[model samples]
Target: MTNTNFLISGKLIDIVSREIIKAELEIKEGQIVSIRKKESVPDRYILPGLVDAHMHIESSLLIPSRFANLAVQQGTLGVVTDPHEIANVLGEIGVDFMINDAKKVPIEIRFGVPSCVPATKHETSGFVLDSNIVESLLKREEVVCLAEVMDFVGVVEEDLEVLRKIRACKNLGKKVDGHAPGLKGQNLKKYVASGISADHECSNIEEALEKISLGMMIQIREGSAAKDFEALYPLFDSHPEKIMLCTDDLHPDDLIENGHINYLIKRGLKKGLDLFSLLRAATYNPIQHYGLDLGMLQLGDPADFIVIDHPESFVVEQAYRKGKCIYKDRKVLFETNNDIILNNFSRKSILLSDLQVKPQNGSLHAIVVKDGDLLTDSLLCEPKIDNGNVVSDVENDLLKIVVMSRYDNGKPVMGFAKGFGFKKGAIAESIAHDSHNIIAVGTSDEDLLHAINTLIDMKGGIVAVNNGDREAVRLEVAGLMSNKTGEDLISDYTRLRKFASGLGSSFESPFMTLAFMSLLVIPKLKLSDKGLFDVEQFKVINLFKDL
Candidate 1:
């Protein structure tokens, strides 16, 4: 410990300590060597750099390299990322890209073995990960544990491949994550019995409480699709030790503005949560849970701590990882070379003719999405037939929703959904959740066709099609992320937002709302790369016929 490079002494409070103390810290290489003298320090607050307990790097809409730059700026020295979105689109190759990019960053990025690639057997994906793939991925040094075992329905039933994957990760002595939304009673118990150790998809206080009671670490998610802050924040008062913070899926613009874990900290403080508790949930609890090597400002730990100008404002004055400053003020210093690897995965142009639906004399089943929730509201809407063709009525607020397979799966599944708030024209995106499918919502058949085709021409990304004209935004990186910075993505997103607003859509961010179309786990109904999904039943259903 004689080769210490820097001696950082400050006012330090261990997350477990009830009282603050003065400490002198010594760092050699990247690890903390010693801490002595608890009677001298005065100003700086030495705490562990934040850790995002769970997240998806793809959701940030940036490659791992750029996302790291932004995250480190927010004092995040570590994160556990599930690359399921890109893995669903590019298969093993997608996972390799993530691992490769993550290595370029100074922060510690723990890769979670994606438990569900297609997510369910009912969907079409670019590549399918069997038990063999899961086994191989776990052997990697960077792999932490099994990613959110999204197919909870399959796991409970002891589905062969699902069980095999779980056993493989467990055999390697790694943890297994859970994603059972609204699952309670015996089903919840069965789900937990499979060696799955944690959950981040909790939607309500009841669900969070139940999971925590069952010995699962609850990672309170505040992301693009699932927002559980208000309902779950109260847990900090009672179960702060067992609780953690995560941004399961944050958009690029939101990441830039609100930050990753820092935003969650600010919001929690505003709601009257104790500062130490929030810091513990964000830093100590997560690192301890994931067994990360992120060093806190303690004796014999790595010297990774942030210099906060103001703890109340949560202003991150400077961020240090391994005792080296990576981010200062609002700028980041990283040797980033985010190379784009675009695999053209768009399908042939789909038209109004492809989305045709035959007459059903009974109640027409419709997939509905709530304004601000990821879980949908399933309802019945009478089929509106105009000149022997099912049409989209903007006045009735029932615009046509379609999900098309883009994985060259031969048999493309199409389904109708309502309540997307589309007025005139249509919008299509290749950014559908889980499985990257083409989802379109439009006022007319022509506009819907135009929207889908526009997304196809761009290779991948979101597009807004109005009448015969179209605007294509390209995300040619794995069809999930762009190798662009937040400012550029925000500029592009602003255009999409303004275009959708001009078309009479009421939602604050229509593209972000539309992106969740292919998420099969969220309840009520959703269209996937495969067929119409009834999430409650956890099975594929006939779009035209009621079963």
Candidate 2:
């Protein structure tokens, strides 16, 4: 229920003043009109609703409206969302879809102009958002900043186009987020000097501290795949003001099971970090940095706040936005409208011959994936030859990985990947990072073809095929997000994950991990629709070692 004028009583957490006081707030017309100190109040705590510093809504496999429905229940009233995933597939049309869909819900969905559409030249994206298009996007009232500049090499090498995009954001007085993982010393200095303000890709304390020292805000990322909070939590005590909390890419199951920023706050409290500091990181820090128009429980601000059981428990009981109770009684009060579906999938089914790799004389250069980390390692292993072709070796845990172009009927690019631990099935998804192409990894050629064909038939979705069983979830929106409600998507995705796990793959989020396998920007090695990309070298290398 929403009332223009209402009174709420609780122990208000004054984040700015760093104190808690029993007070009764007089909310008039969706603004905190008055705050009167009370002698006693209900046994609940009122604080500013949480904000996700950085995240990709597409990664959750739900559209912005559906994502907000789940996020608001977790006390997340706002999210700094980067629409680059969709931008790569559908360009500006995809971004407009996100902004328009977000309007159907009350949650604040701040968008950023994707700085890297294709991410790198080693991959093929359906469309490119060049500097001209980027400047046009930055002019939008809804776009607050330029998304992560994954092309760090361009900035360091003084690429004119890359610098042009940065200048556009700077000239507009907007923020330019960075994405230089493992960069340090002179290169880092040069990249930061190019006007990059914040980074959420730091996986270690030293990298985060060095960037923080250079006036770059660090976002401690704890997502479905890459987790860095444990390594960077010390910043909460040392540089609380300079750090914020974010989940760069959270899967549907993770969002449903673990909660959102509220989960991070609960974890921080258990770590014995200062309550105010943790609260500030999730609330005040990102708001100030992003210049969000959210209330901090102050008079004359928007009436956006959450009611919690207590600080120690950190369990959000209710969430209110603009004086409206959006979440209460373990349910989202508002309904999501996401019936429209937009997609850009044009790939066709592949034959088993398309998956064949002629036996080479040298060892294979395989991508070695690490569980819970985006950074991958490169390994040269002996190929298992079968019927005059190099094949998947299940005993060695090395599987055949393929990246097929979704933009056209192009031949699939084949490579080898370790760490999925798939004994007998194939998982294919059109949710590959950046490009949103069809990527699959399997232990057998038949299963791999089956999984990829299923996604092709669905236009776009995730599929896990083993024996005669097939589990799938269709992502009808840009082949990156689903139009289904959060609950439906979660149920379907959970079952697909369980089916993939039953195939003998043991990764916590195999589909999410698989999605990143084609992202050329992240690190060491990756696969693209073109070929196997060596990210460290910034080039596509031959799969056969010493070829």
Candidate 3:
């Protein structure tokens, strides 16, 4: 009765028993029909396909179809994406766009309906995904769980509205995700008590262990901006069952240069952890936790699996979905999207004076940028007054940073930032987090003005202006994504990075690091369109330290 049949002989990884047996896998009609023992040890390892426990496909700067093409090359057969970034920009329509586009490819993009739309009321974003909206999304076929409940304070304080959304998911028997960065002790206990099961924000192993002890899955994330793998990789051996790998936000260059979940697998293998545990974290663990349908090569299971070379390198030789070859030998067989631009933007240029921060006789509250880390330090610097304005001190490396409200019609708010390492020129991105307003950092008002205006002129994109030369990369879709192939996004974004590097930036994923500067959550200090935000204090502090 089998219409199509194939024999895959290899050392099949037994995900449940954590053992490998020489076997010949028999697959037919998109299902693993049987697995029979063999006497010979094969040259490769056959196991379930890789999975990314958490990610924002938009952060890759490519649409679902294009993103899938790149992801499968790294053997990432599935992704647990939040879609919160684009959802914040375009609401339900945005979530629908990602889903419909994903249907064009084979990669199973399991999306969590965004739990928080605007994230917070502190800044302006395009739309709101309230409890009513979430309830509606939960009923959809693609919605698996509630996206991260970033409002940890709301859960701890038991705020009515935030609790309402969590309860709605729980009522429907869906999982609730967590985003409690640096959360510990009783507060951590209180958060878990509210039914949130996983967290990707633990920056250290101790914090990761503590959360795991309290029954929370710790997603070890190493992405373009926030790198937490070093701090949490020990969990691969310590608490293998409680940890998962994720790229919270990955740029196209990282995907091309480093890799996806496979990147962590290699790092963990080099550290000499058990192969069974490493492979489970990369594949089986997420499947079980998310209740995903991705296979384990079991009979009657959907034939979504991979054949990889042995543990020494663990290079995926072939990846299959529905028993069809989607990737082979580092090349994806899938077709990605072509250039299809779409955005919601209106060009509103600003004058250089609008970017000025006048001096005051007080310590300046500046955002201290850390390379490859999302968490920033609230630094105190003395204001440098020049020509009746508290201008950027390029000599001291304290430059001006601004967040212009793009959604609800607002002007730019100016503040100071340290550690951007820019000596001249300015950089701007429409990819600012949450509200996603245009955020820029420059050594002077003139440079900052030019960079920001370039994005405004493009309606939504990243731009760098150094001296007289300018380079811009447009993300026309909701100003958060591009409808181009991954190759083109990588090529275009690379040029922008090269342009910024020509000025003075030495930061890896510079534009990615720039976008997080305005993210009000996960911070000590950050800039939002409202003003200079003191995150720990949870209030908008003045740019100058003194009144």
Poorest 10 consecutive residues of model 3 by lDDT? 338-347
- Judged by TM-score relative to the true structure, which candidate is superior, 1 or 3? 3
In Å, residue 469's CA in model 3 sits off its true spot by: 0.4
Whole-model lDDT per candidate: 0.80, 0.91, 0.85
Per-residue CA lDDT of model 2 for 1-547, tens digit only, reads 5666889999999999999999999998898999999998999999999999999999988999999988887889989999999999999999998898888898888988999988987778999989999999999988889999999999999999999999999999999999999999999999999999999999999999999999999999999999999999999999999988999999978887898998888899899999899999999999999898789998898999999998766778988888988889898888887687788888877888999999877899999998899999999999999989889999999999999999999899999999999999899999898798999999989899999999999999899999768999988888888888899888888888888888998788888899999988888999999999999888999999765
- Weakest ten-residue segment in model 1 by summed lDDT: 1-10
True-structure lDDT of candidate 2: 0.91
**lDDT accuracy of residue 56 in candidate 2:** 97
Encode model 3's per-residue lDDT on 388-469: one tens digit a residue. Answer: 9888898898988889888755778988888889888999988999878889998888888888888888888889998777
- Poorest 10 consecutive residues by lDDT, candidate 2: 337-346
| Residue ranges of candidate 1 with Cα displaced over 4 Å | 1-4, 7-13, 21-24, 34-44, 344-346, 409-412, 544-547
* Candidate with more favorable, higher TM-score: 2 or 3: 2
Model 3 alpha-carbon drift over 4 Å, by segment: 1-3, 329-331
Which is the leading candidate under TM-score?
A: 2
Ranking the candidates on TM-score from highest down gives: 2, 3, 1
Q: What digit string (tens of lDDT, one per residue) describes model 1 on residues 270-309?
A: 8889988998999989888878988767667777888765
TM-score versus the correct structure, for each prediction? 0.94, 0.98, 0.97
- Of candidates 2 and 1, the better by lDDT: 2
Clashing pairs in 1: none
